[model samples]
Target: MIDICEESLKLQEQLVAWRRELHRCPEVGLETPLTAAFISKKLTDLQIEHQTNVGGSGIVGIIRGGKKGQTIALRADMDALAIREDTGLSFASQNGNMHACGHDAHAAMLLGAAGILCTRRDQLRGNIKLIFQSGEEGPGGAKPMIEEGVLEDPCVDSVMGLHIGNQFHEVKNGQVGLHYGNVMACLDSFKIKITGRGCHGAMPNMGVDPIVIAAQVITALQTLVSREIVPTSPAVVTVGIVNGGVAYNIIPDEVVLIGTARALEQGVRDQLAGRIENLVAGIAQGMRGGYEFSYTYGYPPLVNNEEFTKGFKKTAEKIVGAKNVIEIAKPTMGGEDMAYYLEKVPGTFFFLGSGNPEKNADYPHHNARFDIDEDVLWKGTALLAQGAIDWLENNGGPA
Candidate 1:
């Protein structure tokens, strides 16, 4: 509400510089040492109190205001994919890693917010925690950070973060998109192994066919959502990996199947592993074969707090015009570890549309050529800064 739009806009050049600098040397997963050091240096320069090496190459910066009030946290992911850059820009990375997911832009925007909030720390009605996390691509950094207590000490009243890219088709360039409830699916995975007696290639009844049992299991897995789950509720069960015998002439004694499952609701998610196991067990036994099954629950469904999202929307509307703020029509099947933070706290995650065809920045996330429209960087800065301030101004108290 302080009309920091102009200030945010003025830092456009700095934002681009930060993004490009980070982009030039991308690091992947939880091993982002250089990226972490760069962010710590920037926070040090801003004179913001922070902690590094949090939850594996993660950084947490605290901005305490003069007034007694609530606390809110702004988060940004810092990990890159293991892809080599293909973009012809001068800043295109020569290293083996790539910030193909717009994480570089995410960090730059949060740094911009830090700079803005740092100058006005004393006048604010609440405190702000800036979380720079790594390993969003794999293994996950959010859960570890939460385990390490990133949401405690100051005891965050609310939390928020944003992703920059074309994940949501409904949101155009420079627009902000959000969903009231479920916005992303759970990142859960499962593995199934079938065992049977091995025999010669020509023998049919001599050996139990594990391959045949696996085929049945795979086909039946698809029907879990189509038949078992409610038609209205969105869910997916995909078998991405299937491994068995190398030779075609022989029926192998064992077959292995690996797949991922996604759901928007907690009940559906909770039922997936058990349901899958039961289905697989019945089929394997019915087919006269033995089996092994394992299910790992990753990130939970990313749900937005209704009241928090509504409040943030008003702040978003003020930062970017009302016309630029839009509701995401549907939830994406893709998963994010940000869901972990939202589960433990009242918060919302949003999208900062960076897809611009003219600048050749419309490539999908995780692509080697993916890039962001630099013009919208300031808008991201303002939205995060304003969103945190508004949340704190409305809710007063701290840990």
Candidate 2:
């Protein structure tokens, strides 16, 4: 096997520069023109066969080895958030949008992986597909990519993705965190509108107060999370936004509440939804107000295939040593669109710690201050490259 780690070391500066360039020109979900163009140019320069605009602004690069074996996919999200950059770094986001999720690093690492695999194609055992996805933050883009037949064209038997997290110490560099079974929770948002009679605030008893009704509904929502749901299972009901009266002297006719609910188990998610509806209706009726609830499902919970990830653990052990690989104690509540890919094909998704406090790169994801240790970029690239090549060499073809 070729020493991918050593090769990755030589490409460190190039990867960091690429990541910073992407960071500066951050784009929102499903509209990554400049980002896709940059990826296309790099792939073209490397002589890698690719397909652009697969599933809306996403890019896919196919590098074939001398001998064909199994086809595996390595994916990375390429979209930034709507938040303004506050880090004040030299390569801070140009516009209001910023890479608060470290997707810029993910994209750069995958690009670096492609370069390494292409240069060492002679030693590669099978074909590798590089997928640069967009809109992973919300309103999923993975389903569309899968619907567009990116996986079918190459007949990918398995897929893998890496996320950067700010959870570990500097000495924990190159560590791989894995979780079996459910690794992320299902997310769904709900909007509730309460209608009531509007009257002068001076005589509150003259009309049904929507603000009071909304407050009651919000408090009642806690019963579903605490009193009714199973104690062992986890669930949350948060009312992040509530809008009602415009003036202090006048009571508004309607109050609108918007927020989200998350649960690891599907049954729990369903139960919570039902309970929320009942609670809202009961509360509104008690206050002589009418209520309507609108719900929309987001990404499904991420369930990692145990057998597939067992194979991945061995690959990680070989590439980064056993000491660097650690199994997660518990799954996270955050949702990821990578779950869509795993639903189609068996795979393992993991986190690569890129937080180094000493370098002031330890902010959490989605925070404006969020930054990542660029050194982890090379390690991530090497790991993805080795995982794809190693899996094919051992598994041969799709089962």
Candidate 3:
């Protein structure tokens, strides 16, 4: 196995520079032209072959090994969040967007890994596919990229990806978190529009109050998780948005509610959505009103392939030490579009601890103040490169 740690450490300064530059100019969603250009430029500098404008702004860099074997892919999301920067770092984004989810680090680390692996191409046993994806925050970019044939041509046999920051706070800095199955939850968004008769608030009986119906619907949706779902199974139903009413005296004719549901199991996820729609429709009818429910299924639960995860964990232990490898106890309710890629190919998505309370870098992901401990960025790069190299060496070529 290559000394990836040493190679990554040698390029630590370059990694930090790339991360800071990306942090300064953050782009959001599928429209990540600047970010994609930057990544393409880096690949060009590395003398690696890559294709851009894939699946609407996604990029794929192909690094072929001297000794032909199987193909493996390493993915990183390149989009930023819409949140304004509040970290007060010197390199904070000036475009009113932030890399609050450590995507900037993700891109930089992948680049760092690319640099190391590219130079050692002769030593590698198989090809490496570096996937720089856009719009992981929402409106998923992974599905589109896969549609564009990212996994074809070279035909990737296995895949792997990682996230930065303390997703599980229990894991300390420099620690790598790995899980076998159901590492992340499936996500589904729902919108409900309740329609009723508008009338004077003073004459309560004159109006079919949609607000009241919406409130009832929200309360009833909670029961889908607490009552309908088995207690042992994990599920979440949250009504994040509710809009209605016009004035103190006048009742609005319509009320709109939007929220998300998350579940670890596919059955539970589908059941939750079905129950929610039924509850809302039944409640609107009971209140003498009409309702429209729209449910958008997002990413599926990220289940780590047991075989791949075991190999990844062993590779990670080699790079970060056995003591630094932490086994994840349970699955997180949060959703990851990387789940899309894992669904198509055997892969594992792990977390790299980037929190350091001493430097005030322990904020949770998606927060405006969120930032990663820069020192750990290279570790991520090294771990990814090492894992890919090891997998190819062990598995040889695709069966």
Estimate TM-scores for all models. 0.97, 0.95, 0.98
What lDDT score goes with residue 157 in model 1?
Answer: 80
Ranking by TM-score: 3, 1, 2
lDDT of each: 0.93, 0.87, 0.92
Can you write out model 3's per-residue Cα lDDT over 284-348, one digit (the tens) per residue? 99889999989989999999999999999899998889999999898899999999899999989
lDDT per residue, candidate 1, 216-281, as tens digits? Answer: 999999899999998899999999999999687898999999999999998998878789999999
Q: RMSD (Cα, Å) of candidate 1?
A: 1.5
lDDT of 2 by residue, 124-229 (tens): 6678889999889867779888999879766888999989866433326568888888888887889999999999999989998999999989988988888988
lDDT for 3 in candidate 1 is 70
How much lDDT does candidate 2 score?
Answer: 0.87
Candidate 1: residue 105 Cα off by (Å): 0.7
Clashes of each: 2, 0, 0
**lDDT comparing candidate 1 with the true structure:** 0.93
